[model samples]
Target: MKRLYHWPLDPAGRLVRLALGERGEAFETLESPPWSPHPDISRLAHGAVAPAIVDLKTEPRMFACGTRAICEHLAETGDGTALLPESAADRAEARRLWAWVEAACEEVTDTLLTERVMQWVRRDRQPDSARLRRGAHALRGRLTFMNGMVEINGYLAGRQVSLADLAAAAHLSAYDYFGDVEWDAVPDLKEWYARLKSRPSFRPLLADRLKAVRPVAHYADLDF
Candidate 1:
């Protein structure tokens, strides 16, 4: 059995989940929020966090930490939908864009998503206006870039869905969960997201709900 430890809204974890879904792999999950690290995660590896996985059926109990390690491991081993493209050039492009998505959204996650969790889930204090503004500005730039990519390639990396599309979708889904995305501003990207959102792989993410905060009204609406 494969056991995945992950936080629901973490883009890395979401990406891994989407990959697993696309590959038709079944695995149980344990929620491991980064803010308050789960004790069991430390047993896997020092400083291990969500998005980690352990293959309980393996001889030595194989384990992988982080998205790059886990997702790539799945890509290499799985028999279902190919996350990486077939051709070498397309594979390289997929990987490049996959890495790019994580990098590009780092600032937005660190600022906007973090603030949302703090303000809503934790309810510790008021959110910082400066951080929210900074993240919003960064998100807008990313949306523009992604919009252009889809406009040119039909998908993030190419004609078919790849890890790049999954990666981009994961991050954007998190932002949309908190009602941060300006979908109307990016028409092409909005259409692309709608298609991805309609997929079975995306259903688990759309169903995610926090006890403290509800997702935006249109979050689970396929046609929206």
Candidate 2:
């Protein structure tokens, strides 16, 4: 058995989950919010962050932290379709876009998603309008760029699904959970997302729900 510590809404966590799910690997999930991680996380040297994984099946055990470490480990060990492309050039392009998605979405997550989580989950503050606006503005720019890429290449890195597509979808899915993504504004990207949403690996994320917060109606709708 393998165990995963993650926050449902964290894009990095979602990326790991997607990779694991795509590989058809079963893992027991333990929720670990960034503000207050699971106590067991302190025991593993490389499991300090959410999205960490521990392979209980291994004799000496194996642990990995963060998206890069976890996803790469799974890609290497699992007997499923590779998340990274086979061609060297395509693999490099996928890695580049994977890094780019995280960098680009950092602002949106720090602002919009953080504010939403603070306001609803923490329930200790009001939503910051200024931060929300800033996040939305940044999100629009990212969506536009992604839309162009999908329009030209069918997927972020190429015709086949790759880490780039999964990474971008993970980030965008988090935003979409809050109804923050303006799908109409980026038609090509929206179409691409619909295809991703229909995947079996994406079902668990669509079903995620916070205690006091409800997702938007279209969050789980594959057609939307």
Candidate 3:
């Protein structure tokens, strides 16, 4: 059995989970909160981080740390649906957009999600209003850009589902868990998200919940 270490709300971790689910790979999951990661993670070849995977089926035990490495590894090894496109050009486009989604959402995660995690999960500090405001501003900009892309191309890269869609959806779903997304402001993106949410691969994420923190009412509602 394969073992995966991840944080429930981490976009990178969520992306890896979605990729694994999409590929129909079964694996055991161990939660490794960002504030207090699993000790084994620090002993890995790569620096400590959630979303790391250890393929126990391999001869010497293959290990992959971080989203890019893990996701690409799964794409190469798994035999279900292809996450990356077939054509070189399309693959390049998907990769470019996938990278863009992570880079673009960095601010939102660093600010808003960080504040929430600190305040609620860790109970370490008070919520920072400035960070929350900044994150909200950045999220709106990203939502508008994504909405435009979906409105024109139906998907982030093209018609076919790709890594870009999964990456974007993973990030958006994290924010949506906290009801941070204003779906009314982006109808096209909202519709797109609803479709993604209805997929079988998304069920696990929809069921994820922190100890004392509850998700939005519509977080698990596919129709919403």
Candidate 4:
């Protein structure tokens, strides 16, 4: 049996889940919040952060962290999903696109999420309207670049689906839950998302609910 210690609402954790779905891998999911940061958190050097996995076959007791590392491990041992392309040129392109989304998407999405989403999850850190507004404004600039890519090609990385698509979807889906996405701005993006959200694996993520915040109806609509 394999176990994944994860936070249900974490975008980074969702990255790993998407990879698992891509590989058609099955593993137990455990809700592992930082109840006590003293021993379990990375700052404490105990277990890994959320979405950490333990493979009972080899090292059931030990755990692994880091999104790419975990997904790469699954791809190697499981169904060998063509996530990172083998061709040098393709791999380089894929890596480049993945990095671009990582640099901007998470920060931008987190800016909105931390303000509207995570703030509700944790009441201690008060939301800052000024910073959140700034992040939201700056994030729109990335939309221009993303719109261009979507317009030129069907997918975020290239013509076909790849980790880049999953990565970007994971970030944006969090916002979609809050009705924050301006779908009209990027029809290409909207079309691509329509297809992405249509997938079976995506359904569970879309259906995911946070007790503190209920997602918008469109968030679960595959057609939307």
Candidate 5:
């Protein structure tokens, strides 16, 4: 069986899981926290990243990491739900949107997570409140920009849902758990997000619990 090394709380990992489930592919799941330096994951992969995959039947079990690359690989290696569009133009557009989402998540989303949510996960010195504040501010700015992009006929990557939806929703869902997202400020995005969150694959993500974290009722509420 194909194996996926991952963390339940990770936005990037969640993106991969959502794609995998949406495509109806089967794989084993492992919880590997990104910040941990211990000897975790498998020796075959030679990496401890939350999205590293291994195909046991292969000589070199290591497959790939990173959200977009793995999603494309899975879509190619399986049946149903063709994630990568067939046309060169559509593929280029998909990749472009994927790249933008990755940059935004790393530069904005993960910064907020490391401060607000992931702080409790580590036995670190302290959570940088100033950086958290900065990330919160950055998130508002990015949300404003993204909300505008999404307003033009819906979905972040364009008309049809694509990796862009998975990427954006994963980050927003993580922040939502921390009460970081001001949903009213972006009602269109919020409505779209509510639909995404209601999907079967996403319920696991919404239901996942972490100590000291209490998600709002609206987190699981399909409406609003």
Candidate 6:
């Protein structure tokens, strides 16, 4: 069986879970908190971290350390709806958007999402008002850009679902878990999210729960 080491709220980890689910691959998860590294992570490699995967099914145990490595690996090996588009140009566009989502969400995750996790889950300190505000401000900008893309193309890169959609959904879903997303502000993006949220691959993500930090009421609501 394959084993996935991941943090429940990490967008990268969630993205991998969604990809696995999309491929109908069954794997067990071992929690690797972002604040506390899992022992097995270092065992996999010197600086390996959560969102890593180890395939014990392989003779020598195939392993990957990051989203790019793992998702691309899965896309190559899995037999199902391609995670990437077929055309060369389409593939390039999808890859570009996929990278962009991660880059663009980095600020939001580091500030807003990180502060929320620290305050609610760890309870180590009070939430940082400045960081939260910064993250929210950055997130709004990203949402507006994404809204325009989906409004014009029906998806991030094109009409068909691709890794770009998954990447965007992963980050957005994490923010939504904490009720950070202002859905009303971007109606088109909200509609697009509703469609992705209703996918079968999204079921496991909807079920995710952080014991100390519960998701928002609408986190799991497909219609929301």
lDDT of 5 by residue, 1-224 (tens): 67777777678888988888778767787777776622445453564356767676777664777775688787678775666667788777877877787787676665778776546656465777778888888889878877887888577766777777888888888878778899999878887887788777787787788766667677777885
**Which sequence of candidate numbers ranks them by lDDT, best first?**
6, 1, 3, 2, 5, 4
For residue 117, give model 1's deviation from the true position in Å. Answer: 0.8
Cα RMSD to native, each candidate? 0.9, 1.1, 0.9, 2.6, 2.3, 0.8
lDDT of 6 by residue, 33-87 (tens): 9878889899988888789999989988999989999999988887767899999
For model 2, the stretches where C-alpha displacement exceeds 4 angstroms are: none
* lDDT for position 14 in model 3: 93
Model 3 RMSD in angstroms: 0.9
Give per-residue CA lDDT, model 4, range 1-224, as digits (tens).
66676766667777777777777767777676544322344632354566677776773264568677776676556673576766778767777887788788766755777677547767667888886887677667777677788777787767777777787888788767778788888888888889888866676687688887788888888767
Ten residues in a row with the worst lDDT in model 2? 42-51
lDDT of 4: 0.73
Model 1 stretches with alpha carbons more than 4 Å out: none
- Return the top candidate by lDDT: 6
- What's the C-alpha lDDT at position 90 in model 1? 98
TM-score: model 6 vs. ground truth:
0.98
Taking all chains together, each candidate's TM-score versus the true structure is 0.98, 0.97, 0.98, 0.87, 0.88, 0.98
Q: Output the TM-score of candidate 4.
A: 0.87
Lowest summed lDDT across 10 adjacent residues in model 4 is found at: 36-45
Q: What is the lDDT of every predicted structure here? A: 0.93, 0.91, 0.91, 0.73, 0.75, 0.93
lDDT per residue as tens, model 1, 1-224: 68999999899999999998998888999998888777888988877777888998988999999989998998999688999999999999999999999999999999998998899998998999999999999999999999999999889999999999999999999999989999999999999999999889999999999899999999989998
lDDT of 3 by residue, 129-152 (tens): 999999999999999999999998
**Global CA lDDT of candidate 3, please?**
0.91
Residue 187's lDDT within candidate 2 is: 93
RMSD of 5: 2.3
lDDT of candidate 1 at residue 37, scale 0 to 100: 70
List the candidate 6 regions with Cα displacement exceeding 4 Å. none
Summed backbone clashes in each candidate are 0, 0, 0, 0, 0, 0
